[model samples]
Structures are given as structure tokens and as C-alpha cells.
Target: MQQVRAVVAREKDAPVTVETITVPDPGPGEALVRVQACGVCHTDLHYRQGGINDDFPFLLGHEAAGVVEAVGDGVEGLAPGDFVVLNWRAVCGQCRACLRGQPWYCFATHNAAQPMTLADGTPLSPALGIGAFAEKTLVHAGQCTKVDPDASPAAVGLLGCGVMAGIGAALNTGRVGRGMNVAVIGCGGVGSAAVAGSRLAGASRVIAVDVDDRKLEWAKGLGATHTVNGAQTDAVEAIRELTGGFGADVVIEAVGRPETYRQAFYARDLAGTVVLVGVPTPDMSFPDIPLLDVFGRGGSLKSSWYGDCLPSRDFPLLVDLYRQGRLDLDAFVSERIALDDVEAAFDRMHRGDVLRSVVIL
Candidate 1:
């Protein structure tokens, strides 16, 4: 066991504190990682607010990249000194999903068998099972996906969560293809990534919709051909106008709210796809729509979980693209901060002041 400085949320809606916590050495099938950089994501704030669960004294931060320091018994395909992106979906090979060769939807995932705790021996529930706001963390060996050592950790680490989710919502769940007209609602980190992903997938027109003009500009930088200020204009009508009076072939909902979802549902071409990648609170429910309209849609309505990505396959490919300059992962990084600045970063995120505030360990 070793003590490290980490950001901890001790109670609901309380300010997070940098506390000394104990991280146990890797047990069987686990690995120890020296986290190089971690992104301060909204999900971490959700955990702090008790929005995820009543798991108190949570170890926050998940989206991370690092180097392996040690590996436990029975671990293979990974070793000390490997540069890796930590993923939450560490597939359990024997699960039914994996048995069918669809590990991306693996129902059973892996995490460290042993627990990291506070100095007083209280267990800390790791955010997204990663808990990477510390200098070092322990995770299932399978969670460490090796990527290009030359890639920027701050940029590529985001693939562990939001970035990947946005890109995957288009590339995987939406099945965006060449010449497809795509529209991404909510120009946050995830929505901007969807815009980028649409461009990467060869979409002809990628429309970005958001209430914040600043975020809309960010989406343009990431490759949105058109921008729609939902607050200023009717999003559905704007999208239809931009797409030749039809609509987008795929509309990605990244805001995770009823209103944005409704816009996505309506702002798609007949037989177009709607991919919901946003994370909504448990209390929220889907909006009421006519069964007749649902039947008339004649297309897929899908929800993207972590962009339905398989980290082992996608991470390395994306890091290579970043290295090749074909994909601009760096643009997603708004600023670099230390572990102590997480609470302030959260405030900035809430105010739409930044895209991502990465913690440089």
C-alpha cells in the first residue's frame, strides 16, 4: 500500500478536497498505474453530487492516461512501462456479450478486486471505476489499453470517457457513413467530438446546435459545417433548413435533456438515425410522443454507451490519428490544471467557460 494525494468528494454537493489516500498494490488481474494526466469531466461532478449513488467519500476523476508501474499475477499483454489509456469497460471474456464477439457491449466488466481507501481505512468508491485524480491508481489490467507513447496524454486520455462517447455516438452507434448529413446537439465536449467524428467519417454536412455561442464556435473549430444557436432559433427548423429542407441523416443528442432529445427526434430526415449519448439524471424521463410518430419514423433510435467503443481496438487507432494530425484531439483540451483546482474547474465547466480542464499530475 502507498499514500498519494487525490481529489475526494466526502459528501453530496460539498467542495472536493485534495486528500491523502491509500492505494493498494495490484492484486491478481490488476495493475498499478502512475497517472500522467486526467481530465476533469462532468461525470466526476455527478459522482460528487450523489447523483450517481450514495457512495460517499468517492475518489473522483476517470478520463486518464498513464504509464503502468506494476502488474499483478495472471496479467498479460500489458507490463510495467507501457503507456496506456485507462478504460472503464474492461471486458470479461466469458460474458455472453464477449462470447458472441461483441465485447464492446460486454455486460460484465472488470475493476480492481481490492479497494483503495482513505488514510482512516474507509473505502473510496472510484468514479467510473477509475479514480484517476491521484498520482497513481490501481485498475484491472484489461482497463489499460496501450496506445502510441508519443501521443499527448492530456489529449488522448479523454478517449477514456466523453471524447470517445461523442465520437462513438457517430462512428459506432449512429453508423455515420460517407456523405451522410449529421447534426450534433449540445456543443459541449461530447457534442463537439461528435461533430469531429462526423467529419472524420466523411459526412458532407455536420450541423452543430447549442445554446451557447461559444460552444457553437468550438464545434465549428472541430468541423461543424454549420452552427445553430438553439436558444436563438428553433433547432429543429434550423437543422431542416440547413439540410436542404429534409434534415440530417443522423442527429446526435449529447445534452441528455428532454428538450434537446425532442429536437433530435424531430430534426432528422425520414428514416434517419437518432443517437442519444448524453447522460441524464435518474429522475428524468423520456418525453411523451405519439406512438404513430414513433411508428412513422422508420429508423433507428439508439443510445450510445461510452460510444459503444472497445478501448483496446479504438484507443490505439485514435492515438495514431492524433499523431498523424488527421484528428485534432488537442483542441478538446481547454486548459491544464493541478489536482487541487478540480472544484474551480467544475465551476468553469458549469458556466461553459471551458471545454475540458485536464489535471496534470
Candidate 2:
């Protein structure tokens, strides 16, 4: 057993605190990772707010990169000292999705066989099955995807979640192609990445829509060709005007709100794709668009789960691109912080003061 200091949310709406927790040695098919960096994501806030569940004393933090420290029996293709990004989807090969060769949609994912607990033996529910806020964490061997060792851990760690989701939404779900027009609604981390992905896929114009001017500027740095302050203008109208009055070929909704979804719906050209990458509260429902409009659109309405990514295939590729300077992974990192600074970072995130505040260990 190993005792490590980690941030834990003990109750709903309570400020998170650093606690000493016990992590056990890796069991079969698992590996122990010494986390180098982890990014603060909205999902962690959701868990802390009791929006995810009533699971209290949650061990929070998931978007992470680390070095493998140990592996248990049956682990293969990974070793100590390997640089890796932790992924939530550790596909079970026997699942239906894997059988159909679509492991990205794996119905059964893997986590550490054992649990990390508080001093009183209360098991901590790891956010997204990867409680990486600590100095070290245990995870399924399959959850650690090897990436370029030379890449910056503070930057590449983001690929473990939001950044990957945005990029994947454009490349995989939206199928952005050369000369196409794309618009990303919401210029946060995921939305900015969507803009970058669209540009990388050769989109002629990438429009970013957001209420916050700062976030829009961040999107611009990530490759947005145009910007729309949705708070001041009709986003759908602006998107249409930017795309020669035909609307965008691909519209990514990253805010996960009904109003923004409606904008995305009306902001796409005929037969265009709409990819929803945001995480909405359970009480939120689909927008009240008429069924006739849905049918008349003549295009796909897709929900991008983790950007429809296969970590084993996408992580290394993205890391390489970052190394080549083709992808600006570093742009997403607005600040670097210590683990003890996470609470303040959350306030900054809530106020839209930063794109990402990465915790460096």
C-alpha cells in the first residue's frame, strides 16, 4: 500500500481538500502510474457538485499523462518508465462493440481491480475511473496509452479528455474535409480544439462562436478563421453569413445547452453534420425543434462520445503532431498550477478566466 496526498470532494457543494489516501499495488491487468501532470476539466467540477452522482469523497482528476511505475501479471506491451496518457476507455475485447471492430464504443471498460481508500477505509470513487490528482494512481493496463516520451506532459495530458474530444468531433464525427466550412459553438477547451481540428482537416473557414471574447481569442489562436460573439449577435445568422449564406458544412455544439444546440441545428448547411460534444446535466432535454425540421435537415445529428476516439490510435498520432508543431497543444494550457492550487483553479475556470489550468506534480 502507498499513502499519497490527493484532492478529494467529500460532499456536494463543498470545497475540495487534500487528503491522504491509500493506493494499493496493481493487481492482474493493472498498472501503477506516477502522474506527471493532470488538467482541470469541467467534469471534475461536475463530480464535485454532485451533478454526476451522490458518490461523495470522490477522488477527482482524469485528464492526465504519466510514467508507468509498475505493472501486474498479464500486463503486456507496457513497462516501467514508459510515458503514457491515461484513458478512461479500456476496451474489453469481448464486448459487442469490440467484436464489431468499433472498440471506441466499447460497452465494457476496465478500471483498477482494487480500490483506493481514505484513512478510514472509505473507497473513493475515481472521477472517470482515473483519479490522477494524486502523485500516483492505479489503473487498468489498457487505460494507459503510450505517447511520445518527449512531448510536454502538461500539454499532452489534455489529450486524455476534452482536447481529444474536440479534435475527434471534427475529424471523426463531423468528417471535416478540404474546403468545407466549419463552426464550433463554445470556445472553451473542447470547442477550440474543434476549431483546430477543422483547420487541420483542411476546412476553408472555421468559425468560432462564444459569449466570452477571451475564449474566442483563444479559439482564434487554435485556428478559428472567424469569430462570433454569440452574446451580441445571432450565431446562426452570423455563421450563415460567414459561409456565403449557406451556413457551415459542419457545426459542433460544445456547450451542451438547448439554446446552443438549436443554433448549431440552424447554422448548418443542407446535409451538413452537427456533432454534440458537450456534457449536459441529466435534467436537460433535447431542444424543441420540430420533428419535421429534423427530417428536413437531411443530415446527421451525432453525439461524440470522447470524440469517438480510439486512444491507442489517436494519442500517439496527436502527440507526434504536437511535437512537429503542426498542432498547438500548448495553446490550450492557460496556466500551470500545483495540486494544492486546484481549488483556486476551479474558480478561475468557473469564471472563464482560463482555458486549462494544468496541475504539475
Off by over 4 Å in 1: none
Specify the poorest-scoring 10-residue window by lDDT in model 2.
278-287
Model 2 lDDT at residue 185 = 99
What lDDT score belongs to each candidate, Candidate 1 first? 0.95, 0.95
**Per-residue lDDT for 47-154 in model 2, tens only?**
999999998889999999999999999999999999999999999988999999999999999999899999999999999999999999999999999998999999
201: Cα error in model 2, Å:
0.8
Query: Which residue pairs come into collision in candidate 2?
Result: none
CA RMSD of each candidate after superposition: 0.7, 0.7
Count the clashes in each prediction. 0, 0
Off by over 4 Å in 2: none
lDDT of 2: 0.95
